[model samples]
Target: MIEPTHYLSSTVKGLKPSGIRKFFDLAASMEGVISLGVGEPDFVTPWNVREASILSLEQGYTSYTANAGLLELRKEISYYLQEKTNVSYSPSEELLVTVGASQALDLALRAIVNPGDEVIVIEPSFVSYSSLISLAGGVPVSVQTSGEMEFKLQPSDLEKAITDKTKAVILCSPNNPTGTLLNKEDLEKIAAIIEKYDLLVISDEIYAELTYDDVYTSFVSIDGMVERTILVSGFSKGFAMTGWRLGYVAAQPEFLSAMLKIHQYTMMCAPSMAQYAAIEAIKNGKEDVLHMKKSYRQRRNLFVNALTEMGLTCHVPGGAFYAFPSIKETNLSSEEFAEKLLMEERVAVVPGSVFGESGEGYIRCSYASSLEQLQESLRRMQRFVQKQKAGV
Candidate 1:
């Protein structure tokens, strides 16, 4: 008999499916489920950005763009980075518009990794980092972060993870699941370690614009590190354009060239209409982004306060939309509690173990849903916790 598994790449055979998708699938089958499992903004693409896409279609601008993406969009992305983060790039040589930050992360790994090279990932992180590193033939070295430090990376942890085989370290600030952010000082300390070891960095800053703390800092903002960092971000979170499938990579000329080749062979280009819409959004969508961020700030406070008041140990994340609360006090591992909550209370949230082992006693709740839904979720959660305590 013919077998598909025999034909699959060794890397494909070794990888597990994403953890985030498990709860998403569960929520789909449950009636009356209020889910905080999704990480994307609930907002739709802004009207002007949608209109721009429509106009592109009407004008018959449906042809494929340059292998790198639209020239105009690349220029706009370059300007946007500088204006927002004080990071400069040459549109022609330093930027490549890929499908999303997801793709850019993959491309960076593929471009730089040789088999058996090490890619350092700080956990609990977005699941894709480990999978992508594996797919690119690199070994993922997980350096665990803790809830004690609000899940932020410490200099000692970074120091312990590096060796001669280390090629790149993945850094996600305004991080997924935990929402812990790395401020300038945090970046500086980490950057110093990377510089000392002569290692490169693949920074995922997709949530940069959503930060509620002081201004977001790009790796490019720090001295000398920009030359060795592949800056990955997308319009999905900030502009509520998750479905648009547009994101970019900004890197040194040599690395950008290698990523472009892989992107060309694999994707050719991003969608034409998306490129046009993105150009308009970058040039004039500041108000739209700001309006969304302001709303998220309010939701953050509501969810965090409710969780702590209910006696679950929680942290106030500096950025991103998630509230990570420790579930140990409930005497339940994260998965067991999450499963029970869904079956009983019908509220859907991701178990911390889905991210990595370090996340065993926690669960990630996204505030991206409406306030009404969040309020009701809290009431249900309170009941759920109380019942668990009473041996119900």
Candidate 2:
């Protein structure tokens, strides 16, 4: 018999499926499941953005765009970054459009990682960072963060993780699963370490616009940091444009050119209409982004309060739309807690262990759904917790 597994690359065979998707799949099979697992926004793409894409199609702008993406879109992205973060990037030489922030990260890794080069990854982060690093022929060294520190990556830990072979570090602000935004002071400390080690940085800022903190800071905006940082961002989380398949990377030409080579050979370019619509988004979509951010803030408060009141200690998320609550009181592994909660109460959430070993005693619940849905999921979770306490 022919076997597909035999033909798989070692990397593909070793890679595990995303932990978030496992709960989502289980919830789909069950009736009446209230899911808070995925980090995706439930909001539709704002009308103006959609209209722009539609208009592009109507105008026969369906041809493949330049390999780096539309010049106009790149220009807008440059302006947007400068306006928001005070960072200046040359659109022609320092930016490359990608399928999504995921691809941007992949391109960054592919461009820099030689076999056996080590990349430091902050733990309990988005699941793909380690896997992608491994797939890029780099070794992934995890540095765990803690809820006590609001899951912010510590510079001491980062310094300890580096070795002679270390090449880069991956950072996610307004982090997924944890929702901790790295503030300027902490980032300055990290910048010092990166400078000391001469390591490149892949900064994922997809959730920057959703921050409820003081202001979103860009790694590239930091003095002297732009030369060594590859900034990855997308329209997904902020614009509710997950399906648009649009993202970009900004770096000095040295790194950007290398990443562009991989992108040119692999993806060719991002979708044409999406590139056009993204130009519109950058120019006129601030109001919609703010509106969604306000809604997410309310949901974050509601979800965090509900979790704490139910006896699960939860840190208030500074940004992004997730509430990561400690389930250590139940003495259940994260997977055990999440599975039992879903089986008993028909509520779905991601087990923390999926993100990394440090997440074993917690669970990640996204508040990106409607307030009504979040409330219902909380009620079910509360009842489930009560049952666990009663040992029923």
Candidate 3:
């Protein structure tokens, strides 16, 4: 008999499983584990957002929305973006509501990437970026960024990565795992290189509102970039609405139209109740977002300092809730360090090697847990580090 595995798509067979989820699954199966592995917000979805969804359901608004999503939600998204970035988009023509910012990203990739096209993905990036590119039939080219440089993608480095087959770049600010926020100056320099290459950019800004020290700059707001940028964001990170599964994409109509075609056929529309809730979220969720941001900032401060105090060198994250600390001093690979820490201390973190080759010596610890949990995890980590240093 023919093997069933032989019928699987070559692309699916070749793909590796998520590195973050591997540790999360192991921690999930074990008791007494302090998981700093997953990057989800610990906060409950704000009351008002939940109420809005409940109201929508009570109103019997359970039917599928338009393929692009409800016009009202898209309008709210447009207004929110305009208020934040001063960039205007026509809700009907230039916006699309997706299942999540992740879906928006996938749609953008699928819309633009042709088979064999090369897309530049900066290292230490969100794990899904490369995988989504491959699923879109594009080649993912890694451009390494180091902790020494605070993991910022330098313009010079970006220029070196581009070739004739290069199609676009995937940029995430207030980045996942590292929490590095690209400054306006950094963006301007990078924007110049993008213009020189005439390349497109898919900017993932899911953590836009979680920025602590500096203002979050939208890539579309960069001069000459609005037309070339596909802005992907959602309520997941900032609004504590990951379970809601709502996100959006804003781009030129030409690009939006293409993505909409795929979205229409595949997703049809975002959940109707979720769209209603997202409308409420973008319209009146500011105070709740501010509260969450304040809490995440406190956690970040406590967590990064604790990591440093434990003798691990960690770059202070400007946004998002993760702390990537080098584990090189322990003389263990990233995976080995994480495994030993999990087994010995019952602390779970994602190994940096899974992110990219450049991420090899670090481990990503999310501080999205409660303050009490973070404190206890740090104590356990400190003990583990001391033991490792003593060669015990």
TM-score of each model, paired residue for residue: 0.99, 0.98, 0.99
Give a tens-digit lDDT track for model 3, residues 186-234: 9999999999999999999999999999988989889999998999999
Winner by lDDT = 3
Which scores higher on lDDT, 1 or 3? 3
Model 3 poorest 10 in a row by lDDT: 277-286
Instruction: List the global CA lDDT of all models.
Output: 0.92, 0.91, 0.94
For TM-score, candidate 2 versus 3, the one ahead is 3
How many collisions per candidate?
Answer: 0, 0, 0
- Candidate 1's C-alpha lDDT? 0.92
Candidate 1 lDDT, 3-111, residue by residue in tens: 9888999888888987779888999998999999998899999999999999999999999999899999999999898887788899999999989889999999999
lDDT of 1 at 141: 96
